[model samples]
Target: MTAPITMFGPDFPFAYDDFLSHRAGLGAVPAAAHGTEIAIIGAGIAGIVAGHELMKLGLKPVLFESDRIGGRLRSEPFKDGAGAYAELGAMRFPPSSRALFHYFDKVGIETIGFPNPLAPDTPSTVIELGGVKHYARTKDDLPKRFAEVERAWAEALEEGAHYGELTAAIRARDVATIKRLWHHLVESLDEESFSGFIANSKAFRELGFRAREMFGQVGFGTGGWDTDFPNSILEILRVVATGADDEHRLVVGGVEQLPRRLWALVPEVMAHWPSGTSLASLHNHVPKPGVAKIAPGTTKKFAITDRYGTTTEYDAVIVTCQVWLLSARIDCSESLFHHDLWMAMERTHYMQSSKTFVMVDRPFWRDVDPATGEHALSMTLSDRLTRGTYLLDNGEDKPGVICLSYTWSDDALKWLALPLDDRVRLMLHSLRQIYPTLDIAQHIIGAPITVSWESDPNFMGAFKANLPGHYRYQRRLFSHFVQDDLPEPHRGIFLAGDDISWTAGWAEGAVTTALNAVAGIIRHLGGTAHPENPDPIDRWSDLAPVRLVE
Candidate 1:
């Protein structure tokens, strides 16, 4: 049987999964470097992971956060909850996210199949388009046109990019083959947008414009990715090629528990620190205030000033916050990064997203309609303002949660000005048009919750989605961890976050990149990886990402 596709990159195809599972435990710093202070900004997954690993390596990591921990993995529980909650940021996680799953497994976080549209776990799915609704227990129940669109997408992938071979290479961990195929694609499609790739594909061209429009509206694996049409085809290809869209699962209780637990976890074995040491224990159970400024100190160190007028200096700094924050929220020194790196940070594009959720009395949507004998409501995908609505059932006799609406990009922008009450009403109105007989408002209990990440002062947007012609910028950021070529001033401050990774929006990227930063910090402090379990930087030259000439 073929091995399952992991997020072993086509860009930098390193076996991070293998590295973490090894007994070496992420390498070690010298005795002199032990307890060396390294400042990490943002208490999100990236920051937390970096701190955890660095602490294991005998380094003292000081973490600063502007808001709550977990970053984009924000899960807000309902007041009447039996573990029912709204996943405001990242809800569904793909099985291919092996690195992220490693942390989940370490923390004993359980997961269940997410009820994505057409997923087997979902009881039924409803697709609404052009004011028409169709109910399906599976894809086979959809009209033949949907099948044709699915086939066209497959054909487009095979014809335009030889996607099958690329995926096979990735599964086999064939670095040379993966690089050869992906290099050709980067050269050909770096400047091509996703919509352009569709229009130009022979299969899509033959399928006609209407089919293309439907493909956008009812996209496979999640739903309605039309908002991403303007992004690089390379970005879309990376997702599908690595199987990042398949077999998604949600945390059983909430994803917030993963980071929170990690903060308090005392690893079975570690360097320098005592057996009872944990990140929580090190910081006295709370992280420092948000950072306000970072600049060069007089004695070859980085001075960090937090929001509360406290200043401290560290040997090295790793920033895991959104790249835009460096410019928008903090007063950062220009000399900390090279001009090219600065331009890449400036060019990074973040997609906006909004999610409105409400707690319902029970799983009332599962009731069979007496007149039609069909489910009253289903996991819905629509072209309406409420792009996608999900029914999250906790259990029998317990209050259920419903994600009334989840929208991205343009659709998300529409909800930016509306208040929570107005947002909930508008979503209910849109959903009602599909289920005319159902009064969704009647089942709603307690106050509704809503969020527009772009509106949040700390995070300007939901997540990064690179646009066409932005691959070079991505290359710059991803390759920055191996900083031997950079000048002295730019050497100490490293970048690690989803935005700095090849796959920006996914948590796997955050984990993998944090590992990269950990390795970088170890090396900077005169440490080396165990020979048997080398990190990404140890294999950098052989597996370095293909660079496009300017």
Candidate 2:
């Protein structure tokens, strides 16, 4: 059984154990609903998990992927193919993400603590501020100024956001306390930006904007909170208060395997469908064409036209693609969903991101500097062009990988037009300025690969970060997964992905939302959640996610 999660705001905070412990087959497919076919858009983690679980419940799910499987959970192999690869997206997993771990454990994925710059698993960290450099192997070694900034953030959360009370209420599953505490917060903080919260808070007010500047340059968890400073304060509180930023681990081989393994799994038995049916068998071991358009069909079903113009009919469709695709890429009908839902999807703010990586001969940064007696290079962070650098050591005699640079938002936008070689050169140039004596280029043994998510049509941008005053928009999107929230016309289609979830940018949100949609889909098809286990919304409706409209 999975652990129970405590959360704030509209992020569905439900017990994963309840989902597994239900007596009825998860979603409890009805005799009439047996062999119900579901059309799942996108082959990302969200789509794959939803499709996989639906299959287990005796439903047939056909997945369509415009690109390759795994979507954003992709791992790119280095050019020379020396078994070295770079995690182009989603490189770490937090222990608090029980829903994600459930899948990871089932797939037998091996994980170790990711070297998160100044994190414990990392041997050292080099932080650059202004023009000065400070090298430290632990948090204690950080300059006093950095310590002050960290404390201010902690204190700001406690006073300005009521972080402790909210988390404690959630941990205890005290619904009454949670609703009272969180509803007040949503009203007060919904229109507030992260920077605004930090500015007016007692600790931050005393420390001033300088502290805010440092936090933005090298954020504690995801790095460079500045890009997100304009985002809702509630979003940041949900991440830190829930312990989602602590105790992170990286999948050993690659995180993408979690989804890939699931695709290969063939259930022992299924309804109507033959035993040992897999996604490959269902699609004839071929790539299902991309969906070009979606509209309501003549009957109470959905009509999805593929890239090749072949239309398919299904009782329901779960769109796992990012919201922007509905407007920017696909030819979706306006009448298919509520006008408010269209606004939310169109207004979603996807943060820009870029990552440049290279394969190296070995972990040269592990070597001690002869003059300073400190390691040659630690996982580094700076306000320079190369905002942050990460190292991946693959043991002796194996090629090592270095994320030469990882940046976000405006910083990321700077390199959106640069070619891979230009990006690598500029990043190395910035690194040389920090480490004057080290000739880092000599260690390179393979071709470099880079990603500018905003430039890629498949992925308009990295992930979502809700902007100030966007609660109503998010509420519309998040609740869309629940069939009851929609009007008669929109009842047959559902939305599930990180963007629709409260905790965007995390895989946990993607998986959790997908599960929620699965239950909703079952309900829409006249099925039911197990009698032993009430629906998540039904069980916690009193403590339901904060309502922006009501």
Candidate 3:
């Protein structure tokens, strides 16, 4: 694993004393002395990669971020004596994440496959209906309740089977397959509910029994397609199920180690802006009403506000903030920003999820002779009793160091809204459900519940995903930076984010979009760009043969 790069060592960017001294005098920086090639907002993976690529081309790119350098990939010190960090958000990575893996390899960040000891010995997925636990040992073992899943899967394949032979299934005339795929997508993608889709399916009578339970398992939350803009659930499932491997991987040390390495690769030409500073607004030079000034030169300005409310500006700005945050600052009337983009962005739904990290003074689960060594880090589907827990091996030599994360959906919003005491009681209750053998109340060191989706202002949700009709608008919203559409002098402000790329809502998506944005910027700068590898999995016709077992 690569060591962290310490840019500002002894002196933190803004000292508390300095903050107290100049609490109110913060203001925006005025006009630029020279023109900037590119400006990216939100220093997440996409912005970081885009800036890195542009710097390689000898263009001075400026980046802006409202929070820490690593967006969702943040790690906090565990409250227990584990002597390791706990991940607040994203946790797993697949082997097919070539771009992500390549970046890690280039930067010398090592990774190990996500371990599942229960696998082969026991099924990984468990369905908790009421108080009873039904272990899904295999596809065939899915409770009689989920019988409709087979039918839904079959119907989806049948609809698109004809497009398998076509050169471009996307262009095939079979709208039925496309529509079936759209219906199976999560609510965030389409207005129709899973129940509605199952109802409309050929075997509704047979599958309707498990409707509510199945919906909970497969349903997309606020971040899914049902919210602001809906996405095709079928397409997302196809991409996730087909293109990727089943194994999960962990970054050596922590996930933050990955971004820290990427930051080191950035060239000297690209300016490194401090965290918490974001673009407030843009200033343009307009000469006349219908006809604007033709210096052919444009000055990209920003109004960056820091954590302490201190605001500053840069000549050129590279915005890496969330779309919702950026929408507030941009002047849509200039035609430089698309109205459709703004609308879609405004309507985007963020998931209300929470992570409660409990540091135990002792390894309670180990009392039951729990799986030891690298066989830790157990991943389990959530249940009403246990909620859900991802056990992490803090990489400690001692056996007692363990971090338990409770990832809950609607309960999070409710828990966060409740008073402190009520929240604590609820959490303890949830924890007890999982470790019935251990005394959770006595061994607890600290329990910090991070409600990311509800608290973070910049990003309303965790990441972007497609809904039913979202694909129709995705190409337009994601591909907003076509050469002809952008403002003067800067034709390469290609849209790049987890939402913009084909792989939406993952580290891979961020990397893919960054590569695409870099390609666009390189082309505009009269430089060559590298081509991406073709997707290995075929979307339309690669379904596994269905069989009937009696």
TM-score, candidate number 3:
0.67
Question: Per-residue lDDT of 35-61 in model 3, one digit per residue for the tens?
Answer: 344656666777766655554444545
Could you give me the TM-score of model 1 versus the true structure?
A: 0.99
Model 2 clashing residue pairs (backbone): 219-224
Error of 1 at 417 (Å): 0.5
Q: By the lDDT metric, which is better: model 1 or model 2?
A: 1
Q: Per-residue lDDT tens digits of candidate 2, residues 1-550?
A: 5323433233555665446445454656787887778999999999999888888877878898999999889998887757788899889888877778888877788999999977878988888878889898877888788889888888988897677777777666666776777778888999999989988889878887788899888777656678778889988877887777777898898898988988888865455567778776777765478999998887548888999999988898899999899998889889888888899998999999899998889888889977788888778899999998998888767888999999888999999988999999999999988999888899998789899988889879999998988888988888776667567888878899888888988888888888878888888888777777776555546445777664
Question: Candidate 2: worst 10 consecutive residues by lDDT?
Answer: 2-11
lDDT of 1 by residue, 448-507 (tens): 989999999899999999999999999999999998888888887899999999988899
RMSD of candidates 1 onward, in order: 0.8, 2.2, 13.1
Q: Give the best candidate by lDDT.
A: 1
Between 1 and 3, whose TM-score is larger? 1
- Clashing pairs for predicted structure model 1, backbone only: none
